[model samples]
Target: MTTRTSRRAGGRQARQALRAAPLAKETRPVRAGLEGGAYKPLTQAGMERIHQAALDALEQIGLADAPQSGIEIMTRAGAILGDDGRLRFPRALVEDMLAKAAKNITLHGRDPQHDMNLSGTRVHYGTAGAAVHMVDVDGREYRDSTVQDLHDAARIADQLDNIHFLQRPMVCRDIPDNRDMDLNSIYACVAGTTKHIGTSFTEPDFVDDGIELLHMMAGGEDKWRARPFVSNSNCFVVPPMKFATESCEVMEKVIAAGMPVLLLSAGMSTATAPPTLAGTIVQAVAECLAGVVYVNAIKPGHPAIFGTWPFVVDLRSGAMSGGSGEQALLAAGCSQMHQFYGLPGGAASGFSDAKLPDMQAGWEQMCSNVMAGLSGLNMVYEAAGMHASLLGFCHESLILGDDIIGQALRCVRGIEVTEDAVDLDLMRSVCLGGPGHYLGEDQTLSLMQTEYVYPTLGDRTSPKEWAEVGKPDLVQAAKTRKETILAETSRAHLDPIVDQAIRARFNIHLPR
Candidate 1:
């Protein structure tokens, strides 16, 4: 009688327990700020050797084309202006600047929830590039990427759980004027997503105008300065150790205006940089070190990302092989170098060597993505939807890439060997006395959502079940997801008054 009563009461007790089992947080299975650094392509001695080489290069070879203002600033910061017009950083100067640089930085999102804490080996992967063409998957053709295409990409990226931030991924070909293009690009990105945005200015004067626009959106100059939602992707140096003078000016203005800057030093192997990977690394590092000295000379401890992006190319065809094994190693190697300096840094990864999102694209996209994460790249750019050696963007591919990055981040998360996680009780409950299967066990049910990651669109059904589901096309599925996301009102929508004021002031290209 007692046993029967207990069983009857068991239903009520289980119902209460089910109601009390907390639901999962809205956070994605694979999330931003996951710790990486598991894979080290370079040994300790190797990293140190590269370090000295970079230092020696900065001290001996130096860099050329410093604007007069830059020359003054660097000279003030103990960097010697050599007789050859090269700005030579003494080893002491670079080390001093490194010590003065900001370590952890917050890449703010308008929605505070989306801000990125960039410190140490914690990793975040997102999209970025200057692709000019859009791959029309259905039509099987390439066309100029318009302002509309760019806005659409940001909106889609905003909804992807694994995509952490929005970096201006494509050039707005429809807008012709330089100033107009700069303002519109920033506007389109801010209007689309509240996530931390990365954009570029054509020249230094453009930065002043862009900052004014940001002031309007931020309600005042102080507010904008207090929390800069966007960063300037300034390519301060040309390859092989030289400054792009105008971009250096732009970097100064961006820093002065209290905005963060990604000191991007992208060098191509067998092309703009040295042919050997180690040699390429040295050049890239030396250039970015010069950038650090440049930035610190402008303002001490200002937020900056050491963007040491080194790329590999196929030596024979003279074409970029962004998806090649060499490219993956180059990116991963850069990641290790970033950790060595303890600087907040980023590198390029997740590019497709294919013209379209094919099987080749899949392999190419994953190679660097996995390596970049495992090597602990702080901010992994171009980790999704970049194609044709960074010349094209595809909305469908961007959506699909979200699933791909989810798996990569899971690898970065690695395994947790906690007491409960490695429980002998869990094994015995099923094998010894109880159910003989883990399906009905309490631990199995409890750990399901927390321990395992399930892909949203990846099919897990049996062959017959998949057939019954009408054998749905994957690309079509991605297209449907995009349509659904764009159909909704953006979660990061700006205030109506602010939106109206912006439109009234600037020539808004994206229609309401």
Candidate 2:
């Protein structure tokens, strides 16, 4: 017989269970930390303006070379399509889709054993896609990355608790062929570890191969569909507005096959789109929406994440500056747009053009990541250890980034409400000098673990104690932590037969 548990009863039972267990007091209560910094929450008025502007661009300027089928769909749905291929969407349709899209999605990581809950108050951290640096075990730097470098990067990501997902190819690893190499790298990482993976396959065959591997790993097509055993395909929409044929194909295959897709359109202000930040964001949004519509059209109710990496062009030189204020604003705006569409948003943050891990890197990473988190983005790419303008990755940066993400996450945690948290009776008792000392209180001991987050890197000791231990900086502590975690942690195990099948398909030898 099935038993029913009321919500209140369930909570009461959990609290009672906790109270019955022996309490061990070790860590201090976690401090209330900062929320996302410098990000102005988008107002309803501002969002309305953006929506109108996007419609104007679609109707007046019109998008170029969007698939005719997409245009036909929009046109039939009351969008005005110009003879020249520009189409204007009614504000109502845009709002309708926004309301219908799914805002919350759970990304299942490599360890089927572990999953990150993304909706509501929970925040997850992970690195951005496409880092080009190579760092050895001893923290020495190499100029570029190889296939082995990708493997090592996967291993590092697998060990990091803060990192909840993997974006494929950690670097452009070489195999005899790029297509075969793409599939091999994805298989190696997915099989070697258990983390949700994000991959963008340029070729159709590779997409099929990746999907096949996911089905095998997930046990079957049905199970794979339920929890997304494979990676989400990230497609770049041609911006200041359009979707390329290949990207369209990739999106179609991924969405139709029941895999999640992240549609990203990055536009450089004054270069790709208009010089104005607002204009660029509108254009970027339209471009991303166009891609989203395509996916939705192929398979209605397909899971898709709408996103952008819009940044300002260094007007003086035409380079993309990772640290631009415009980028932070775009991240925030994109989050709002995703909310508008009722879909989760992804954006690049925690990255800088700085050559090393220094003040510039810290500030740039902090500002962008905090903005993304505060705006309530679903998945943030480039959350850790990117430098040299996102073309490089450093082991030290990864260590440092863990702390930064921790701080950002702490900000989004909002506030918790419970009877014990309110503690009105306890407060009244203290007011009467009835065991006013919190140090000896049963409540303090009971709630500490639930309320606190112990840091692996930040220094919390006294100056004398810190000096006595070793006056190591945050980076040093992080390095030590990285080593310890890597050493003790085991790679997620895979079935021997499945591993063999993957190896035989790819013609690569599995490590004994």
List lDDT for all candidates, in order. Answer: 0.88, 0.66
The candidate scoring highest on TM-score is 1
In model 1, which runs have C-alpha deviations exceeding 4 angstroms? 1-28
Candidate 2 off by > 4 Å? 1-40, 66-104, 110-113, 116-122, 135-142, 417-437, 488-490, 509-512
RMSD of 1: 3.3
Each prediction's number of clashing residue pairs: 0, 10
lDDT of candidate 2 over 183-286, digit per residue (tens)? 66676666545777777776755778778877877788888888885555565466766656566666667776788777777777888888877787788877
Q: What overall lDDT, based on C-alpha atoms, would model 2 receive against the true structure?
A: 0.66
On the 0 to 100 scale, the lDDT of residue 446 in model 2 is 62
Judged by whole-model lDDT over C-alpha atoms, candidate 1 comes out at 0.88
Query: Residue 78 in model 2: shift from native, Å?
Result: 8.1
Please state every model's RMSD to the true fold in angstroms: 3.3, 7.8
Reference-based lDDT, residue 241, model 2: 64
**Residue-wise lDDT of candidate 1 within 325-396, one digit each (tens)?**
888898889998988999999999998878888889989998889999999999999999999999999999
Instruction: Return the top candidate by lDDT.
Output: 1
